[model samples]
Target: MKLTFWGAARTTTGSFHLLETRGKRIALDCGLFQGRRSEFFERNRDFPCPPADVHATLLSHAHIDHCGNLPNFVAQGFEGNVFGTNATMDLARTLLLDSAYIQEKDTQFVNKIRARKDEPPVNPLYTVEDVEPCLDLFVEIGYYRTFCFAEGFCGRFIEAGHILGSAQVQLDVEQASGAQHRLVFSGDIGRAGRDILRDPEIPGEAQTLIMECTYGNRPTEPIEGLREELRDLVTRVADRGGKIIIPAFSVGRTQDLVYQLSLLFREGALPQIPIYVDSPLSANVTEIFRNHPECFDRETRDLLRKEHNPFGFETLTYIRDVEESKALNELKEPAVIISASGMCEAGRILHHLRNSIHDPKNCVLIVGFQAEHTLGRRIVEKRPKVRIFGEEHPLRAEVKVLNGFSAHADRDELRDYAFRVQTRSGGMLERIFLVHGEKEAGEDLASYLREALGVEVHFPERGDTFEL
Candidate 1:
């Protein structure tokens, strides 16, 4: 079997991998590459190999970075089954459509500037029309149910605990010579004791491992005191009569914050200020989360058993209408506004940052990892000035990052996961390929894993390939 690193190789975004064996080519994850505008367009628009040549696509989750480019891939002629968990398919329906809308709107805005410069108009990567065909190709598979999609290829999905339906993919490939191989792909491994979802499951046995190393360098703060920290931050900002603007992903992170806030409010530990979820996609995704109780953790499931909605509270409102989203800017009282595009590269969060970032009394709460070159990273770095909508704005808002709420596993957790996987393999594991991390993170992880596991660990780069 031949494996190629196509994307998310030494980077935290765009998770695409190609596996070729038994005269069939399969895609691991066809994700959109998120980065600078020029690189983003060129990378996502072009495929290393013909999309039509790929027999099937195995999706990890509904996060845009992991499954965002499926529409474009299908539009480019990939007519094959897109396999994912039932909840993943449902979440992807909402996420992919939102991605298409963003693509069209962003292209239109970019083309307006090009028209003034006499440059040719650019087209969107893909549209809502393109997304429909892709959704039709999705085949829902339940967790741990093994199935064969092509000749000589069979796979199963294990609970990844990252999001509502995130999973780690394990594939068994039989070659023409009748030799079999087990390959496990750790699809964004999640923390063990998280709030909403179950802990990541370890694959039973594997010879080759393809894993993520998103937080390979450092450990995150424990989940224990996170609620108290959030309450303190919110209380401080509200007491100062300033809005606490939170840039969170629409899916996992937003729901996590809401759940925690619900607990705090129930205990009367937080201020009685109004809270708002300002993205339509977040509201829709939250509803999807409610429908997937099988994916919830024991605590969340018990909460639901009591007929309590953890995502909703009396003081909180979900805004969907454009006018209602706009009205947030006119609020005179202190409030908590949680918006989407967690990286602050797009969405209503940009507008919130542009407005509130100039006020020192306000606070910008960052609740997830921010990729390089993103506005969220700039805010985290406390840049003096940041550009939003082609205009520079002073970044005076107090920036507070709460990494405890991250869904991705930290360094210690990742080490423990690798150890468990290796142990489960019964010393038969051959090699480990690390992806979904930056250069330093991958290097740090490679060094640590080599010393601990005493195995061949390679941090592959884009276009790097190896034969097994």
Candidate 2:
């Protein structure tokens, strides 16, 4: 079998991997590459190999970075099945449509500037019309139910605990020579004791392991006592009569914050301050979350059993209308506004940042990882000035990073996960390849895994290939 690292090789975004065996080529994850504008367009538009040549794609989750480019992939002539969990399929329908809308709008805005410069207009990667055909190709499978997706490969999805329907992929491949191999892909491993989803499940055994190292070198703060911290922070900002702007992902992080806030409010630990979720996609995704109780953790399920809505509260309002979103700018009272495009690359969060970032009394709360070159990263770095909508704005808002809320596993948790996998493999594991991380993070993880597991570890770069 031959495996190639197409995307997310040494970076955190765009997770595409190609596996060739038994005269069939399969894609692991077809994700959009997120980065600088020029690189982003070129990388996402051009595939390393012809999309039509791929027989199938196994999706890990509904996050844009993991499954965002499926519409483009299908539009490029991939006619094979797209496999994912039921909730993943449902979430992808909403996310991909939203992504297409963003693409069209962003291209229109970019073309306006290029037209003034006499440059030729460029098209969006994919349009809303491109999404329907892709959506029709999805085949949903329940967790742990193994099924053959191609001639020689049978795969299963294990609970990944990352998002509502996230999963770890396990493939059992039979070569033409009648020899069998087991390959496990750790698809964005999540923390063990999170409140919303179940802990990541470990596959029994596998010879080849492809894992993520997003937080390989960084240790995240514990989730314990984060409620009190949030309460204190909110109280401080409210006392100052300043708004607290939070840039969160629409799917997982936003729901997490809402649930925590609900708990705080129920306990009467937080002051009564109005909170607004200012993204239409988030409102839809939250409804999807409500429908999928099988994906919820024990605590969340128990809460639901009591007829309590952990995602809703009296003071919290979900805004869907553009006019309502615009009216938020007119509010003078202190409030909490949670908006999406978590990296602040796009969406209503940009407008919120542009309007409130200049006020020192306000706070910008970062609840997720920010990739390099993104506005969220600049805010985390506390850059003096940031450009929003082609205009520079002073970044004076107090920036706070709450790592405790991160869904990805930390350094110690990753090590423990690797150790468990090795132990389950019963010393038959051959090699480990680290992907979905930056250079330093992958290096740190490689060194630690080698010393700890006494096994071969490789950090593959983009387009690197290996035969097994």
Error of 2 at 162 (Å): 0.6
Candidate 1 residue 226 Cα shift, in angstroms, is 0.3
The worst-scoring run of ten residues by lDDT in candidate 2 lies at: 105-114
Quantify all predictions' global Cα lDDT against the true fold.
Answer: 0.91, 0.91
Per-model TM-score, in order, reads: 0.98, 0.98
Rate residue 233 of model 2 by lDDT.
98
lDDT of 1 by residue, 1-468 (tens): 899999999998999999997779999999988877778888997777899999999999989999999988998899999999999999999999998887787677768877888989988778899999998899999999999998889999999999999999999999767999999999999998899899899887889999999999989999889999999999999999999999998999999999999999999998999999998897788889888998988998998999999999889999988799989999879999999888987778877887899999999999999999888888999999998865799999899999999999999998899899999999989899999999888999999999999999999989998998
Residue 287, candidate 2: Cα error in Å is 1.8
User: Which residue pairs come into collision in candidate 1?
Assistant: none
Provide the lowest-lDDT 10-residue window in model 1.
105-114
Candidate 2 off by > 4 Å? 111-122
